[model samples]
Target: METDKQQKDKQQLYTDKFFESGHWLLKIRQVLIATIGWLAVIIPIVITVLAFWASFDPRVPHLWAYHEGIYEIKFIGIILIFAWVMTLIFAVSMTIIQNRKRDRIVEQWPTFNPINQKERKKTIDDFIDKRFGPKEFRENVRSYTVKPEQNLETHQIQELYAKKDLDDVD
Candidate 1:
């Protein structure tokens, strides 16, 4: 009922649709969390620098005597200031890198769902421990279900067989 060219055209359209959706989703996700990676790197480094600097001080009351000039600022102050500046640069670099990476992912695969990258692992792990998790995959293999739709196939197949097999087996 359809020509080869028509089928091919339809297929191409579908392919384009898929790619568009996938990449759109991917871009959305990369934007949301790419900075998270940079933050993870920056937060600990900043915390460490702060904690180390707070360990020592001029004691307080005689602080004015120590604050005479730049010298009172001390070696630790310089190192801390430098460290803080470096941390800022590192954080900015991380953000740029993440943004670039996200852009590339979207350009390459526009329809790739971004949510999968963030939630796939956790969803799978939870499904494994779920009520039906014990039956996930047990044929001498450790298999995790990626989505619930997978179960639909087995259910439909069983239903199809049950009607015939019920009378045939007995």
Candidate 2:
């Protein structure tokens, strides 16, 4: 029998395996997506700092020239700002789309739960053994005292089973 920890480890491995596409192109796409996400956040903060610095100080970097007196709005700053906003939107939309795709893929696959076919087979075999008795006496029910036969149809059988006396069992 597998221990709980071992079962959990197996489950983790399966979960990871399902998420990973294994293709080089898919891996590259994931890396690019992550890079864009980080850039979306970091670039804006860096731009804000640079804009602030350029506005307060006369010594502005060569990358950004003050276009107007409106708090150091430069051509480079505008371009960077536009790129940052667009990248942020792209990242969010792509993330949502990718998550939906992954969920759909997972739905198509079989359940990750570990199946105990052995245990189920053993239980079925034991029940068969008890119900049929020993191999030698299996086909010779006349040699042993048999329970009264209930001649019931399919519906009646179902009703009888449904209304069975659970309290009769130990």
Candidate 3:
């Protein structure tokens, strides 16, 4: 049997391999997307500020001369608002779909429902007992109290104690 240290080293090796593999590409992609998203937001705000500054220039003949710049800002605002609304709608729809799917799954498998937790636990325990023989109780731990009327004769209790004493002596 492998020692605990060997088992731990094996687990650490697997974890190291998992992170060293293509997972770095996923991390890079996440950072790249986040950077691009922030740039998208920041670049527009900078442009809007510059446009406002240019619109206030006294050298410009008329206020309507910067009308295109104003229109561009308006367009960006509309796009941002539309994107936000679309994202909100997508999130709400996904939540509803997921809830319906979960409900259907729970209906199909009643054991998945929280109300049937005791039944689920009993089923798992039965499976474990069948797969591995019933788990042995710890030798010295008295998890449950044995009542006098439980049908064990005094001699049987004495024999059990005697066996425990012998084990302790060893």
Candidate 4:
């Protein structure tokens, strides 16, 4: 009942829906990255720099004092610097890992039309049949049935025979 134009519109609608969600996801990713950067990198660096500046005075005591003035390194100042370096490293490593995972997921994504899945399945089945033969083709085949321990009643035997006869007739 559908015309070519109608089919085209449906396909376009499906594709547009996919991309619309993709765009929304991208926006969310941007917001998350921005928020994480602020919390992890920017805030740490700011705090570290403030601590360093505040403790840069002559009154502040040093952990290991060698020379006076600019040469002195306070214990708290060293800790803040180390923390800032670690924060930067953590942010960069997390970004790299996230990007690699995103790439892997995108690469592994399946592309299939939900509307025409049966047709697609048929095409795949046909390819498999041509390449590997029918579903009945197999290396090892077995036929096994579970039997009751006691002997069946006479009626049960007659029913089994009747079922076999029906199968033969078919």
TM-score of each: 0.27, 0.29, 0.33, 0.25
Which candidate would rank higher by lDDT, 3 or 4?
A: 3
Which has the better lDDT: candidate 2, or candidate 4?
Answer: 2
Report the Cα lDDT for candidate 3: 0.65
Error of 1 at 33 (Å): 42
> What's the lDDT for residue 26 in model 2?
70
In model 3, which regions exceed 4 Å deviation?
Answer: 1-48, 53-66, 82-120, 136-170
In terms of lDDT, model 4 sits at 0.59
**What are the lDDT figures for the candidates, one per model?**
0.58, 0.63, 0.65, 0.59
Q: Which candidate tops TM-score?
A: 3
Off by over 4 Å in 1: 1-73, 107-170
Cα lDDT of model 4 by residue, 79-163, tens digit: 8999999999999999999999888886676444355556545655665555545667633436533346333466653354354
Candidate 3: the clashing residue pairs are none
Residue-level lDDT of model 3, residues 1-170, one tens digit each, is: 99988887874434443356578777787789999999999997776676666677866444343687777777888999999999999999999999999889866765434554565456546554554345675244557555455454556533543543421222
lDDT of 2 by residue, 8-78 (tens): 78744345432566767777788899999999999977776676676668787533545563444456679
Candidates ranked by TM-score: 3, 2, 1, 4
Candidate 2, residue 111: CA error in Å? Answer: 48
Q: How far is candidate 3 from the true structure (C-alpha RMSD, Å)?
A: 17.3
Cα deviation of 126 in candidate 3 (Å)?
A: 2.2
The list of candidate 4 runs beyond 4 A from truth reads 1-73, 110-170
